[model samples]
Target: MDKKRIILNIVVVCLILFSLYILQNLLMPKYVSAIVEGSLIEEYYNEKADYNHDIIFIGDCEVYESFSPISLWKNYGITSYIRGSAQQLIWQSYYLLEETLKYETPEIVVFNVLAMQYNEPQKEAYNRLTLDGMRMSASKIRAVKASMMEDERLIDYIFPILRYHSRWNELTSEDFKYVFKKDKLFHNGYYMRVDVKPVTSIPRGRKLANYQFGDTAYLYLDKITKLCKDNGIELVLVKVPSIYPVWYDQWEQQIEDYASKNDLLYINFLELIDEVGIDYSKDTYDAGLHMNLTGAEKLSLYLGDVLTKTYDLTDKRTNKEYQEIWQEKIDFYEQMKAQQYYELEKYGYLKSFGAKAPED
Candidate 1:
């Protein structure tokens, strides 16, 4: 080929690659400014590799909102990270666990059973929350396939611009501002809410014709179990103590049976609300749906014992390096807590936690 033709082709290829990169960045949701749950999955990549976590939490909002890694470190000297997002389905959890194994392997993998309720892909928003932050790999490809709805297309996930090109009309200053950067909104993937929304009423679960979990949900749970066993990671299944959702006895039996059959440890926090010291009147932020920072700390304190005794996790807080790292996290945790309390006192609601300020 002629030199001029070769040079032109090279420029064209470079331009195409660069354009796609920018388009992908632009089309992607900027979770930094709002709905920070979407940012939780991607933020785990920023963790320093020097400190190997002893435990890893994976599931949906229940996992993220219920467990506090900072509290775990403070109370049990256990280093941990939570890879959670809103409505993260079982297949998505399996794929996320598959992707996480590529990095550091924790001694135990905690899978919140709330996600098991969803057998099939539930919503595109939830799928994006769990998948958008994942780095491209075979696991991500598999996860996209497993979690996509009937209307979803694989190519749109691969080339996000195709899916999000319509967002051009809704682009705001925050979109362009955080195109390449975002505010760190979570502490080790725990989304904190310090304000209190006391449980006023408990909702009863509607009777299900089939109390059994779907086959697809069981299939993914089996995959998650095998992945953990293969990686030499113990799987701990837990049902966080949320007051309302009304975790039925039938569902409990299924999980208990699965745990017994698999020989895995399963703890239903709902059964231990008194033991965990979770006072819904003071602990939860959104009625009985999710726990606030206080509830998370209480739950973490309870789990710390199980993790240390059952799993034999060594206390890393005594290490000088870990002490220094956790101190910073502690400082941030306190700062957020104080800020939330202050906002609650002043405004009667959390204006600074996950929501953007009105001035912005």
Candidate 2:
């Protein structure tokens, strides 16, 4: 071919590739300003793990919103991270745990038992919120396959631009600002809420024809249990004390039986509300659906005692390296705490840090 023709072709190809890249970037959702739970998984990759975590918590909002890793560090000297998202499913939690072990195997793995109620994929939105942040790998591929709803397409996940192409017209300033990067929104995967919305009443769970957890749920539970055993990672199963959605006696019995069978520690925090010092009136941000900062810290303190006492875990408080690393987290935690209080005082509600405010 002629020199001019070859040069023209190269320029055209470069233009096409660059255009695709920009279009893809513009079309993607920026979870920074809203629905910030979507950013939790991706944030872990961005985290500088100067010190390894002793515990890795995996589950849905229950695990992320109900526990404070900073509280664990500050009070118990226990290093931990929660790899959780909105409505994270059993298989997704399993895959997240599998992927997490590839990075650093914690001394203990805490799997929130709440996800056990879901036998299959619940919502595509939840799936996206949980799966979109994951870096591509075999685990991600399996999770995508396992978690995809009937209407969802696999190709859309492979190239998110295809799924989000319609988002072009709905683009906000957040989409552009965070197109290449995101702001730090969490402290070691713990979503913080300083505001309080006390629980007024506790409702009983409606009776069902069947209380047996589905085969798929049990299947993944077994997988999670075996995975922990094979890796020499102690797995602690806990039913986070979220006061809404009645956890049935039958469900409790099943998990208790499974824990007993596997020789694992299972603590139903719902039963120990008074011991944990969780005052639903002041500890929860959204009534009883989730805990706020005070509740989380209270629960963390109790659990930290249990973990430190039961296991041969390290107290990294005296380690200078850990002190330096955690000091940065502590600084961010205090700053965000102040910002949340400021927003609450000015707006009568939290205006930033992921939750809704007065206007936006």
Candidate 3:
């Protein structure tokens, strides 16, 4: 074949391969290899047909682990969804909300307050990964404002590929499945057991972490808060429980102070440990920050009750579809409880690891 014909054949072959890859992604069952969190993107795209939630929770893993939208549905008949990541910062959050606003508008927005610590004058490579994977608006103005003094901010928010380029190679078939699971995904939210340990002593001293509130962080926070206020939405700041002695000592007072100044209702569960029934030794998942399934459930129950009382959220459980969704979550919780109990008992490491055996 002549050179032109040869080049044309190669081009045709490449286009065919690209088409096949796209088709594979669209046809594969979700739960194969796609990252679990990417499912949120999938859900967002399909939300117009399936979703009708009254509340939306956004932030990092703290929001995912702490808030159980399913529990809210079960107890108060409110439907909600969590659009959070493992390490989402405020700038990404602003864009995430911006993108979400395109599809749905809930009555309330619960932003996990942990993003406050992500305040940096400049954006880092980490911020880019979140920005790319979540697909936030790459506005130069927003990026400049977010990174006040840091040059890295613009690239991180605009070109997230710089941060998550490695993820391309690490993508496995299972990640594809997770991303495109064919099964109907429900907004079951997270659930964990409550720690029943009694409060023995209070830690001393209150020192804040060197969490620098950069102009960008505050600007986005103010913008988010104002957006909520303008839309007639209620904004709540929540500090999910943690076992780090220093985390509690350093952040408790500072967060409380921020909440007071912003006129936001700050629910510091660290201060209400007794009320929340948190057993640091038992409820913590990593013996550090964040809670496990058991801990998530307990906190969900408490927070669900608190939210019900504080907000005028409506209940949608009467609908047949919602009932089906709640039933699925109930079954999932039952399986989780059984699995956790089995693991705890079989290892004999539960007690040593601070997990108390369930009392009969």
lDDT of 3 by residue, 158-231 (tens): 44344344565656565465443444333443424333343344465356545455566777788888877877
Off by over 4 Å in 1: 355-360
Off by over 4 Å in 2: 1-15, 357-360
Q: Write one digit per residue (lDDT tens) for candidate 1, span 242-312.
A: 86677889999999999999999999999998889989899998887998889999999999888788877
lDDT comparing candidate 2 with the true structure: 0.91
Per-residue lDDT of 76 in model 2? 86
Best by lDDT: 2
What local distance difference test score does each model get? Answer: 0.88, 0.91, 0.61
Regions of model 3 farther than 4 Å from truth: 1-51, 121-129, 135-212, 245-254, 336-360
Candidate 1 positional error at 116, Å: 1.5
Candidate 3, position 113, lDDT: 70
Candidate 1 lDDT score at position 319 = 90
